[model samples]
Each structure stands twice: as structure tokens, then as C-alpha cells.
Target: MNTHKKQGFWHRFFFSLDHKDIGFQYMLTIFVMVAIGGFFAYVFRMHLAFPDMKVPLFGLVTNKDYNMLITNHGLIMMMWLALGMLLAVAGNFLIPIMIGTDDMAFPKLNKISYWFFLISVILMIASFFMPKGGLGGGWTLYPPLSTGDFGYNTPYKGFADRFFTANTFVLLAIVFEFTSLLMGGINFFVTTLNKRAKGMSLFKMPVVVWMINIASVLFMFSVGPLVAGTFMLLLDINVGTGFYDAYRGGDPLLWEHLFWFFGHPEVYVILLPPLGILAEIISNNSRKPLFGYKFIIKMTLLAGILSMMVWAHHQFVAGINPKAATVFSILTIIISLPFAGIILAYIATLWYGKIRFTLPMKWALGAITLFTLLGGFTGLHLGASVFDIYAHDTSFVVAHFHYTLFPTVIFGTYAAMYFWFNKFTGRHLNKTLGNIHFWLTFIFFNGFAFPLFLLGLAGQHRRIADYRQFEFLMQDPLPLYRHIATISAVILILTQFIFIFNFFWSLKKGKRVESNNPWDSNTLEWQTSSPPPHGNFETYPVVHHGPYEYNMPGKDKDFTPQNEA
Candidate 1:
């Protein structure tokens, strides 16, 4: 592995053990996946928006093709892009630096994890080219549909074998992705536990590190059942196992059980890290200490615990015992309290502080605001078992989760990117373009997502290729809503090119940062040079204060560095 200071591109990028290099690799990989996933969204949204109109590149999208696109879109965006960007990119880049370590505890494992992730991505993309499109059963891969007779009753007739092969590839790709994440999680735990700089105890670490650690632990434990479930699914598909086939004493709902168990916790696994990112940005940009630091940590932990208990909430209408549904509904509502507290804490941090409207700050604020609205939506509709039954398979669920995920994943990532672009690449991104990107994203994101709420409320079923098929959805005003969402989606997709161009063009030609601590924020990462070389610091840093100490009394400056002795 080449050192960070090495000149060769492949040596520095392709096969480097340095955590920063690997972090960049993850970011780049996610960028590509984002484009692919967005393309999938564009195609499918086109079908939804204008079902009869001929689509470019593939003509009209059949129901099977729509399923393939939607499944892969969800899979790619959530698992591959969001997880890779937040966990792999932010975790790898920030953890070592913020914790005052030179590198990850297992740098080799880190490198290997990324390579495996790349391989998984390759397999996932290749699966699309399979004889019968891609795995179209959906991202959840529900039992009977996922397992037996892939093309038996679907519109795409006479392609059972092809769909079967595609399903195998999807499962295999997910397996590899999970494997990579497991390796990375191990590295995160070990690094956080054993590798902090002197005086930097666990409590003194930044909230982001704390959140990532919690998320990692949550993922490690929760993902096991799903991994096993996938293998059983594979066997059922290929070797005639009856693990999920109800006809042969296997219950299809059993697959749902296992999937949602991992599935629900997996939401928090992706969520906690980005929530932490928002915490860091909110506190720093507000020029204040993070309010209720210890309390927030406790609340986050409670949320993690409750997240595991709420899996059955998703199964409320899936033939779950009514008593079980009630229990799960109660648990799901309980889980929201901690997050509510966290949100309140963020708001408290912003009260009566000198707020900076920097690029990252704008994105962070947008994320939190949107999240608050969506959080309300979740509480209103998803927390109640009765409401959930109505909204379960509707676009309401789609809008709700997209509200939750897009803000956290997409907006949170943009916050991190704008915040850290200078540190990562030694050049500041074009602020004008970034601001335009942020505004357009915020506008179009809401435009695209809010109508799904209306459609879902009107009982528009999710994952269907054409809304026109349903007479209720075909009624007046609903079609207009669909067209609105589709148009907004197109604008949303096109607006990203501004960010993409800015990212690359600025990488080479953006204004060079004058100082390492351009933000004048109180975090350890800023203590190092712009794009710190080789080992992160010339010497190990000793922590002298908590991660955020903005606007301390008797300080000459508003912010105080964590490393100041």
C-alpha cells in the first residue's frame, strides 16, 4: 500500500491502507452508485409520471422492468450508496482524526472491506444485465416471490430461469455488501475502543464517533439473522429447501419476521451516524456547545434498544397476531421519544447562538428541518398500528421513509461533504454552486416527496409499475399529483449535476484553502493540515477538552480547539 504522500494515482487510490484514501474511495464509489440509482429513479418515475409516453433508452417500462428498477433502486440507494457514503466514507475519514488516531486499528481489513464492497457493486450492476432484467421481487425479497417460480405469474412471461439467476446474483451481491460492512464495523469498534489519543476518553469523543460506535454494534448484532435468512432463501431457491415455502411447512411470514427484525434496526444503523453528523454541524455552526450531550447519548442508546423491538410494527397488517401488533405499536411509539429528545436538543443548541450560514450549515439546517417534518409524519402514521395498516403498502410508507432517508442520507452527506471537502481535497468547493445545489435539492426533494404523501393517503399502492392500472388512482387530481412528483423528480435528478460538476471541478481548481481550520471549529480533525499526509499528525494529539467547546467563557476566540492544553 502506498503512503498518503505518494504521487502515483493507482498506488494512492486503488490499493492504499490509509484510512483517508479508503474514505475517498468509498465516496467515489458511492458517487457512481448514486448516479446509477438516480437513473433508475428517473426511469421509473417517468413511467409513473407519464405511463403511456414512450421512455427513452428502453421504450415503455413494463411492470417487470419497473419492479427491477424499483428493487435495485432501493437496494442501491439504501444499502450501497447511503451505507457506503455515511459509514464507509464518514466513518473512515472522521473516526481516526476525531479520535486522534493515526489510522484505523486494522487498516488492512479496511482496505479489503472496500475491495469486497466494490466487488459486490460490480455483481449488483452485472445482475441487471442478466437474461431477465434484475431481481424484481423487490428489495425486501419477501419469501415465496423471492424464492420459487420467479417468472411464473408476472407480466414478463417465460423467463423463470433467467429471473432465478438474477435473484441469485442479488442475494450474492447483498451478502458481499454485508460482509464488507461487518469487516468495517469490526474496525470501527476496535479503533474507537483502543485507539483514542491520550486524555480522550470515550465520553470526551465527538458525538459522531459515539453514534458510529452505537450504529456499528447495532448493525453487527441485527444483521446476523438476515444474513442467515438470505442463505436459507438461497437454498430454497436453488436446492429445494422449505425454509420459507409455506406449502412445505415453511412459513412465508417467517422470512418477513427475520427480514424486519434486521430491517427495522438497519434503519437506525444508517440513521445514527448521519444524526451524529448533524449534531456536529449544528453545534459547531451555531457557535455553541452541544446541548444535553450526556442526555442525548442516553436517548440515542434507548432509541437503539427500542429500534430492535419495533420490527413487528412493519408486520402489523402482514397477518401478525393482533396482540403482537399492539405490543409492537407501543414499542414503535416509545422509540420516537428518544429521537424527539435528540431533535429538541439540537434546537436548544441553536437557541440564542451566533449561527453561521456556511454551506455545510445550510445543508445541516435543511436536513434537520426536513427531518423534523418527516419525523412528525412517521409519528402520526407509522407509530399507530391502525394507521399503519392503511398506509402499510401505500406510497405513504414510501414518502415517509424517503422523507426519513433522503434528508438524513442525501442531505446529511452533502453537509459532510461541504464541511469536509476542504480537509479532504485541500480546496474549498465553489460556495455559489454549493448553495444553488442546496436550495434546488431542498426545493425539489420536498416537491418530489410531499406528493407521495398525498398519493399514499389516497391509497396508491407502492411498487406498482403503473398508477393508471388502479381506477381509484386514475381519478382526477391524483394523476396530476403523480405528474407533479415525476416532474419534481426529473428536476431533482438534473439539479444533482450541479453538485457533481462542482465536486470534480473544485477538486482540481476550487479555491485552495488558506488555513487548515477554515471553519474555526473545535474538532480534532481541523487541528491537522488540509489533507493530512501519511500518518495523520506529526505527533499524537492529546485531548484537553470535549469535542465541542464553542463560545467558552474567558476565551479570546469564540471556539476553542479540543486539543488545546
Candidate 2:
């Protein structure tokens, strides 16, 4: 950005309040969190596979540390990596550029949000080092364990010791992370709604713009209950209030209700951006107009509506009303329909078109197949109360969760990064290294995640540091599968360094982009200079077409830029 002029070290190193710098900053920071989370997954998975052997870099895994590792791993991936990247990073990067604006509606608030996120990161990491080695109460932080159960189970016992502990940092970090998300959501809303370039109507906006904004609205509505509930939880632990403490006459199920209410919708908050990214990648590579553009938008809105109503399905066994459980069960199953429709529309977009199997497209296909298809089908089993009774809290739930989130969060993120890498760096990543990274990641990701379904069916439960105690769980396929999964995870983590190497190496020495629109895609971001400039477009752009206008009969080039007449 304005590289022609010389700049000081501090100026070059720090972001200068540009949306691009902020977005990229969010992305890089999230990747660091992801690396740490991945390492945690490796440590725990290694322990699970071979309980006798000590983990490398970390010593023996006790029950407490196992719980802490898994719990913080969940928090780190969900809060820091997924939410940060999807809502804040993608919204900041895509909304302004795609809608043909120079910057976010409120830039200062945007900067503040990143600072809050960084603070949350610090608090989260610091939580582990605090007393009792972080809250092992799981990511949900459910009551009893959340109430006083975990406190009592610790090394410090009896009323003589302090009732409250180090896990407070975890909750505190979450408070800040959520607060940051809310601020970023406000910025996305204002920028997209008010700051569009001329002719860029609501309908004319790209699918990603629609998806990110809709995700923001869904989060805004659903997280309010959790936000208020989280404050109550903090009070329960710190001040000895009995908000969720069942032992203290507080209803533990209330915590579940508040959590899943936001928790279920939170899934979509992360899912939609990737789906939108996939839409852009799929359409551009296929050289076809997006199929069912308006229909996709309508279905997404319907899905958001249904997402709020189905939160109770997670509480079917929590002993809510039978009729109420039935309603949520039916609604849970129904919510799948909108996403199914959206995915089918994407598949239809690929039909009878010139398909290019670019690295991004391969990753997109992996996401649709893994997240939308396999993930969707398995989720149905959990939707029904009868099935969930058997599957919930078991390895199946973990598998299904990974199947859904890993593809979108991990696979989908890779796809988007590769697709937009040129725009971000103004240089091409080595296709050779990228191909190796893609195949290894795609194959190994499934290698690890797929076996958990069988383990769940075999009656294996979650969060057990050592499964050797249970003779039935020690059966042939079980241990064998564990080994398979652990080995795969190791390979998967190692493969990412290839991408890391390629990422930084390409920034300086990789082939320079010969043209602005290297991919010949129609989106406005591609129409600008590579990496754009401080204010983005040199002149104000007037949108003349929808984002995906490829393969026009009259044009010499198949693509039509949105700003073109």
C-alpha cells in the first residue's frame, strides 16, 4: 500500500487504520491462534491414542490438564479463530471493497474492536497459567462444574481455600471477545447499508456481503441472551451468587438454554461467510452466473429465522417440556432444509459450465462435500431426540461437530485465503506448494475426523483423558482408529507449515502479478490494482452489473467487471 514512498519501521510494521490492514491483521492473528489450537488438539489426541506414552513438548497428561487442553482448545478455535475471522475479518475486508466503498462506516470503532480482540487473546492465554491451570469445565462452561463442582474437584479443597479461581480469566476473555464481535457487527451493518458505491443496490451486492451482514444480524439477536447470561455466570463464580448454581437453588438448565440459544446460531454466524466465499469461488471458476442468487438470499434469511427457534433441540434431554422438545426437534430438522436448498443451488451453479479446478475450487468442493453434505446428514441424526439420546456427549457429536466446522472453518478458510491471496499480497503463491498443502490437508482432515463417528457408536464418551479404564472401549477397532486419527492429525498440522512458508516467501519473491484482474473475475476487488491503495479505488466506482457476470456472449472477454458500463 503506497509502497513507492519510504516509511519508518513503526509505520511499516503497524496498521494505519485502513480496513485492509485491519482485516489482514485480524486474519494473521487468528492464524496464530489456530496454530496453537491445532497443537493442543495434537497433544490431546496423542495422549488419547497412547496413554502410556508422554506427549512431546508437554509432559504427562493428567486428568486436569486433559480437560484444560480440550476446553481451551475449543474456546481458542471457536472464539479466537472462527468468530474473529468470519465476522470481523471477512466483514471488514469484503463489505467495503465488494460494495465499492473506500472504508468502513466507522473506522475508529473498527480499530478498537481489534484491540479488544487482542486483549481477549491475552486474557485467554493468561487463563491457562493461572491457578488450577484454566477451567476444564468445557467450552460451554455448564453449571455444577461451572457452579462449584470444578472448584471442589481441584487440589485446593474445603472452605479454607478460595472459592473462586483462575478460570475467571476465561470468562473474562469471552466477555471481551463477544463485546468486540458486537462492535464489528455494528460496523458491518453501517458500512454495507449506508456506504455503498452508486448502483450497488442491496440485490446487487455479492453473496458474501449478504451472508456476512445476515450473520451479523443473527448474532446480534441471539447473543444478547448469552451475553446477559455470561455476566450472570461471572457473578455466580466471583460473588457467590446462585444464578446457575443448582446446588445453591439456581437452575443449571438455564445456563444451557442461554448458551445453546446463542450457541446454535453461532454455528451459522461462522458458517455463512464461508458458504458465501464458496459461492464467489465456485461461480468465478465455473465461468457461470450464480444459480438462484435471489433464492439463495431468501433461503439464508429463512435459515437465520429457523436457527433461533431450534436452540431447544440441544436441550431435549435437559428435561424441558415434552411438547416443547418436540417443537424444537421438528424445527431442528426443518432448519436443515434452507441450507440444503442453498447448497443445492450452489451445485446447480456448477452444471453445464466451464469448470476450472483451481486450488480454491478444490478446497471449495472439499467444504461442500464435507461440511454441507456429510456434516448435514450426520446433524440430522442428532436433531431427533431419540437419536440424540444415544449420540449426544458421545464421540459421534464430536465427529459431527468437526465434520461441519472443520470444513467451513478450516477448509473453507483455506479456500478463501487462496482465492484472495493475490489481492492481499499482490504476488502469486507457488502452485506447487499450494497443491501439496491442499491434498494433505483435505485427506488428513477426514482421516482424523471420520473415525470418531464409529467410536461414538461404540459407546465411547467425550473428554476422557484415558480410555484404557474401560475394557469395552479398548476393543480392536477402537484403539486402531485412535492411532489412525492421531497420526493423521500430526500430518495435518505439519502440512500447514508448507502454506506458512509459501505465504511469507511469496510476499517478496513469488511472481509479481502481471495484471490487476489476474483471475478475470468480475468482482470489484479484482478491478482495482493488486493490493489496491490506501483509499482503494483511484476513482469512485459505479456498479454496472451483479458481482458474477461471466461468459457474456457479446464480450470478447468472458468476464464483465461490476463497475463497467
Residue 424 error, candidate 1, Å: 1.2
Give Cα distance to truth, residue 524, candidate 2, Å.
0.6
Could you give candidate 1's per-residue lDDT for residues 1-565 as a string of tens digits? 2144555898878988889999988888888899999999999998888886778866888888898889889999989987788788889999999998899999999999999999999888888887756778888899777753542223333345533477888888889999999999999999999999999988899999999889999999899999999988876766666787666677889889899999999989888998999999999999999999999999999999888888988788888799988888888888888988999999999999899998999999998888877845575568799999888889999889888999898999999999989987899999999989999999999999999999999999896776665788888899889888999999999999999999999999999999999999888899988888777887778999998899999999998898999
Residues 60-85 of candidate 2: C-alpha lDDT, one tens digit per residue? 88888898889889989998988998
The 0-to-1 C-alpha lDDT of every candidate, in the order given, reads 0.87, 0.86
Off by over 4 Å in 1: 1-4, 148-164
**Deviation in Å, model 1, residue 556 alpha carbon:** 0.8
Clashes of 1: 0
